[model samples]
Target: MNKTIFITGTSSGIGQATAQYFEAQEWNVIATMRSPEKQNILKNSERMLVLKLDVEKPETFNEVIEKAIAHFGKIDVLLNNAGYGQHGLFEATTSEQIHRQFSVNLFGTMEITRALLPHFRAQKNGSIITITSGVGRVTVPLVSIYAASKFALEGFCESLSFELASQNIQVKIIEPGNIATNFEQTTKSNFAADEALTDYSDYLKKMDEVFKGIYSGGGSTAADVAATIFKAANDESNVLRYVVGSDLQPLIDIRNGGTDEQYMDVLRSTFVPEN
Candidate 1:
């Protein structure tokens, strides 16, 4: 029997790429998105099933999961990739934004995993792969809420891995650095700002420059993330974390090896140098 992987946020970016990658590898893919009608790509493939799934709404999960199972028999993997970045100063971020960030990035992922646990446990074999961020492991400027959500997800997955081990369910996290995708465009639109509080305008500008520098340097592509996710799903080893993007490894190493003060200084000097 061929393996089936149910992936969320498959409308575009890494999700879409992953769906394509898996289908090319002869795996059944349940590719889900918020607006399935608007999706033109990833259609007509016999092994691919594109469906509507809004991660923020838990009520929709049962129907989606049931349909996926009915179509593919049994899902061997669940890829939680449905999330957006909430970028801006923490002070400028509103309560609603914070809630929205957590709801999608953290709560939604957890709920989906919770709903699938019984099935996975019964099967005595499964893999839960989440697309976290480098920011989840190391902090950066101007995306505090987004980082918080990813951080929460990292902790949640790490803790849940221990509990799920007895059932033979593997929980894995993929931490990717800045990738060339529609993410930056979405983040720009979703970013919260307060013009009245112009005191932080200079800081925001500097952060923008830092972001521009990173993008201009040419980071990893969404396809690279898709490949990494594929490896995480298939690897039978006891590895828990797979860090994608060559640009992110150094920072992760620094965070692991350096003290808190040293890390802070590194971030400050790298992204917020004094003029």
Candidate 2:
């Protein structure tokens, strides 16, 4: 049987790469994005059904779910890959920015997963994979809001996996270190301000430089993450999480073994101090 996957945020970056990987492996992929008209790769793929999906809009979930079922008959996997980063000082970040982060990354994803639960329960088999981040486990300076949203996803998905154990619905989370993609460029920092707040502007610039270095140098590839997602989707035994990146394994191990301070030290060591 040809397994079907509904992936969000397929217009670019990791989501786009993952969609292409799955389709190439002969899976029926419902590649969704906020703008279907902008998706050349998805539009060109015979195995892909490109649809418009804005994760912040909960009302769009049912419509996309209906369309996906109509196109693929059944959804074997739900890849919740749609989210943006909110990077800046917590004091500078507005309530609106916080709300938008949670809306798209946490609440909206929960709504879609909830809607799909009945279908998974009926079929008695399904898999869910979410693209969380290394920040979910260890905090980094200037990205607390984004980290909080992913942290929530990690908790929610882990708990849901235990709840769904008997029902055969497997939930897995992929924690990828910064990757070389447009993902970093798309990050929005709430630190834009005039002379009154110019003191903090340098902080934003420094952080942006740090992000650029991370993505351009030490980060893993999107293709690597796509392969991990494919494994979690097809494997029969349920694995709760898969961490991607060369350095991620040691960090995860340290986090698992030692105190919070020990884990945070690893993060601090990576800090590129402003010159």
Candidate 3:
């Protein structure tokens, strides 16, 4: 029997690619987005069932999960791939933005995973894959809040993997570097600041420039990330995390091999000093 995978944020990017990849392999793909009424390529596929799912709305999980199980009979995988980036200096970010970012990225993912845990526990075998980022492992300028939320996920998934081991539930996180996606264009900027932060405008501008270059096909493709997620989902060994993209490999090597001083030097060299 073909396995069923429930993926969030399927309107585009890695989620969409993952949906296509699995469908090509004859697996049932439940691709979800906040608005299913929107025209999408996945909507036309016989193997794909595009559902409505807003991660922030925890109330929708039960109904959505029921629909998924009914459509595919059983869900072998749950991909928590829905999230957005909030770019701004820590000081410039409002409380609302911080809460919103965490809500959608961290808490929302957690809620959905929690809701599905019982089903996975009952089945005694399942995969929970989350789309985290390299920033989760290392900090970056102007993305402190976004990094924090992913960092929270990394820690949560790591611990959850251990806890769910007895039930044969696999918890994996995909930490990819910048990937080519509409994520940058969809990113909400909250950099509005008063006169006191005028000195940091150039640094913020530089960060925006980097995002444009990184997300516009200059970095890894969405398929690259989807492949990583598929590997983590299908792998027999209980690996905790999979880092995707060549751009991230060097940084991971540095993090794993470099000394403290080297790490600090690299950070300083890459990020412009805030004057």
Best by lDDT: 1
Clash number by candidate, in order: 0, 0, 0
lDDT of 1 by residue, 1-275 (tens): 99999999999999999999999999999999999899789894679998899999999899999999999999999999999999987888999999999999999999999989988988999999999999999888888999999999999999999999999999999999989999999999978898888988888888788788888998999999999999999999999999988889998888889798888888889777687
lDDT of 3 by residue, 1-275 (tens): 88989999888888889999988878889998998788447874667888999999999899999988987788999999999888766787789989999999999999999999988988889999998999998777778889999999999999988988889898888998878777766665444355588877677678777666655647788998887887887898967879888778788788789797898788787675545
State the weakest 10-residue window (summed lDDT) of model 1: 266-275
Candidate 1 lDDT score at position 102: 95
* Alpha-carbon deviation at 265 in model 3, angstroms: 1.4
lDDT comparison, 1 vs 3, better candidate: 1
Better of 1 and 2 by TM-score: 1
Candidate achieving the largest TM-score: 1
After superposing candidate 2 on the true structure, give the runs of residues whose Cα lies further than 4 Å from its correct spot: 188-195, 198-213, 269-275
TM-score of each: 0.97, 0.90, 0.93
- lDDT ranking of the models: 1, 3, 2
- Per-residue C-alpha lDDT of model 2 across residues 1-275, encoded as one tens digit per residue: 69999998898889999998999899999988888886577674567888888887778788888988987799999999999898867777788888888999999789888988898999998998898999898677788889999999999999999998889889999999868787765774344234566777776677767767765666788899999999989887767889898756777788899988877776676664636
Backbone clashes in candidate 3 total: 0
lDDT of all the models against the reference?
0.92, 0.84, 0.85
Q: Name the lDDT of candidate 1.
A: 0.92
Which window of 10 residues has the lowest lDDT sum in candidate 3? 186-195
